[model samples]
Target: MENTTETTKLLVSDRCDVCGAQAYMRVQLAGGELLFCAHHGNANKAKLEPITLEWHDQSSDLNQA
Candidate 1:
């Protein structure tokens, strides 16, 4: 199935997907998945719609950690 929802389109980086706060020195896997903090990621999501490919979701815990 193809994901058309803005929530699913954005690809999670191997870095900090939460809060979009990536550290200079960190650890991440190829697909381990990076998660974002709900408060930050979803807070300004509406404004990011146009430029972002993701809807910004942190409702559920990501498997990265």
Candidate 2:
């Protein structure tokens, strides 16, 4: 998939599927959507990217300083 950033902000209620931290990335797969915090997202990117239909990433928001 083409590299693109999603504009919509992720809600605070969106928790990481792996660790329950605030999510900054959303991976849409054929099975369903998975919300992930920056750490887990990067950790799983290689495996997930091949199957992800849409990768809505806002991890950069964490560096807005």
Candidate 3:
């Protein structure tokens, strides 16, 4: 058995690469990491999903207080 843990997380300070909004998703690819806000994430999902290694989504956290 093996144990694995998440090494990176998208923080409030992290901004979307496209829009400069607070990032809620972090996409890991061969090139590098791409941070995205909810809007941009959904817009590019079709293209990124195939090549993404990790999709670190934290949008649900927005509802938390």
Backbone-clash count (model 1): 6
Question: Order of all candidates by lDDT, from best down to worst?
Answer: 2, 3, 1
Q: Model 2 shows how many backbone clashes?
A: 0
Clashing pairs in 2: none
Per-residue lDDT of 1-65 in model 3, one digit per residue for the tens?
54332446667799999999999988989899899998899899999999999888878778984
What's the distance in Å from true for residue 1, model 1?
A: 13
lDDT of 3: 0.85
Q: In model 1, what are the clashing residue pairs, if there are any? A: 17-35, 17-36, 18-35, 18-36, 18-37, 19-37
Give the winner by lDDT: 1 or 2: 2
On lDDT, the leading prediction is: 2
For residues 1-65, what per-residue lDDT tens digits would candidate 1 score against the true structure?
75645434334452344445532112123434334455554554555545553233434534454
How high is the CA lDDT of each candidate model?
0.41, 0.89, 0.85
Runs in model 2 lying further than 4 Å from the true structure: 1-8
Which regions of candidate 3 deviate over 4 angstroms?
1-6
lDDT of 2 by residue, 1-65 (tens): 75344344688899999999999999989999999999999999999999999888888889983
TM-score of decoy 3: 0.83
Candidate 3, clashing residue pairs?
none
